[model samples]
Target: MTLYRATAPHGVRPSPNIWNHTSTYEIENRAVDPDGQLAAALREVASWRARTVLDLGCGSGYHLPWFAEEAAQVIGVEPHPPLVQLARRRTKRLPHVSVLPGTAQQIPLPDASVDVVHVRWAYFFGPGAEPGLAELDRVVRRGGTAMVIDNDGTRSTFGGWFRRGYPGVDPAAVERFWASHGWSRRSVDMGWRFTSRADLEAVVRIEFDHATAEAVLAEHWERHGEDSGGEGDSGLSVDYAVNLWWREY
Candidate 1:
């Protein structure tokens, strides 16, 4: 009786982050993008106010409440079972918000059903995401906008760190793929500011592979010092760069 099985063939795709470790991912979300730059970009693309919005891979429905504030209806689609349950609980108070277990490859929505689709730091990563793009064409109505936000691992301190951890990801190539497909890009300056060294380390550990996480942490402490800061506080901040890709149907 799951809509996900019908939409997502070959089963659910693997997620980079450990959504099972909810606390770790939550800290990561809080630590990143303290500024409202990403939200501003989304607003500029398409105001969800009074419109139907689809949040693909909306783990735990973190941003569902914000979208529900203005959107007439908000659909949060996540493949993970526990995360889906958590998302439902989180949005139980908001009648307009509904969470479903699904994948980006096959969105469980009708044709031309949504007015605005926003995907931020989700599973529609770089290459081999054409299926999701096809779904967008089917679900997004005319004049509707589809936006995707991802880390620009090409420049800046955060980019450098990401490159060190994931040498396989080619930011330039990813940009090219989007451009070739007629998606426009906008660069945003975001950053990670953690309250404590433990917080910083915890977020990093989830972000990268085990070996890469250890290496990155070692390098981080080496550059920033073991104390994180000169004083007693263990706070750390790193400037991050991101790319916002969008297209209109």
Candidate 2:
């Protein structure tokens, strides 16, 4: 049974340039969740053993290996064909993992088939994700958990940049959307620390537009803590907060 089907919105998606440059996107992904706070947050809410895991928008499969380590079976679903191919390549050596070409509105999984559903940055934002939300309801069985790791761009130091980048995204409306749909949220701080300055610059480029990127770069150069892992010498990282929404149905 499928609760709701997913389809790409009429005109909103990451630019092809963004999708085409897969390596850059991966750098940004690595930088965003450097501390794995999202995973830890989900585990804190509920634990699993030999559970079935579904990673929506699994990208180039950067985190699949980690999930495969604990999950008895792991399935990664991504809409982009190239990314799906990349994800398949990433997991070729892991017998317990599989990658599929699909989207959130239409998760390529059976009804009530998964024990844990995990997504980061790639899923959830505001009203547009309602169908996808319903799909979650269908796939996550009773006692199962769905975790969405997205930035609470309303708070945190980088919040300003995020909010500015997407001015129309009302955080208030987003909170309402999730709450109305029977999901609960908890906020936690995570960090992203890159080992090299070049890696840091590459991440910034992927995250912001050219003008904003230039502005961010200049501002950072003027201020010394820019490359300091967003926390001075604390591994040169930034404190990122994510909203973990889950429901036991």
Candidate 3:
């Protein structure tokens, strides 16, 4: 079930996949980064332990509890009212974690209020996200770190599918955008391992349009017939590449 608002807030770009297919999106979340490489990389740059952490575009508050475990204070900001409600419900028991209704272009927090900012697969995409970057600059204190994670469409099995799905996104331009902004990029290799083929297909369908999803699944099936057993026992595993863009304020 999806919730609808008569008029969405300004600067809010609805994500239909997550908004309409929340349960399937949850499965996608579970299937991503099983190795914890992204988390490890974030800690290596700036540890959030005992510091205030802001999770931008934190949908359904999936990662809020994880941050709350180490961060002295964890704030999850999302623009969608339904998602904001879901996030609040998820972190209701955690005193250190708070969910707020806000967008990347206009965050609700005060200046220099956060020590670390985590943005994963959110709206901080390259080129057109200057407003969000400005908001990041305003909220992240001096010496604080801000991390943005996005798919590296230059490599990996999932990368190939991503490139095909969104032909407009240029890998070179994206890299240049981050470099020009003084943000450093770290390429991390991760993998999606699903427990069942049905789970894998469901996640892929939400990620891409119908045709692209079908083609991707067909290619995947050809490459590794049922149960290609490697790192993933279920045989539905795909290598994924991601760029971790970060900067110290």
Predicted model with the maximum TM-score: 3
Residue lDDT tens for model 2, 1-249:
011113443322454434657787777666666666766787887666688988887878887898888889999987766678899999999999999987788887889999888887763445678778888888988888887777688787566667766677788888888899888889878766666566766777777778876786566655655455443453346555667777776
RMSD of 3: 2.2
Segments of candidate 1 deviating more than 4 angstroms: 1-11, 229-235
**104-215 in candidate 1: lDDT tens per residue?**
7788899999999888886455677887888899999998999998888888777887898778888878988899889999998878888778788888887888888898
Candidate order by lDDT, decreasing, is 3, 1, 2
On lDDT, the stronger of 1 and 3 is 3
Candidates' lDDT values, in order? 0.83, 0.74, 0.88
TM-score of each: 0.90, 0.86, 0.94
Highest lDDT model number: 3
Residue range 78-167, candidate 3, lDDT tens digits: 988889999999999999999999989999999999999999888445788888899998999999999999998999999999999999
Residue 145 in candidate 1, Cα distance off native in Å: 0.6
Candidate 1 lDDT: 0.83
Task: List the candidates ranked by TM-score, beginning with the highest.
Answer: 3, 1, 2
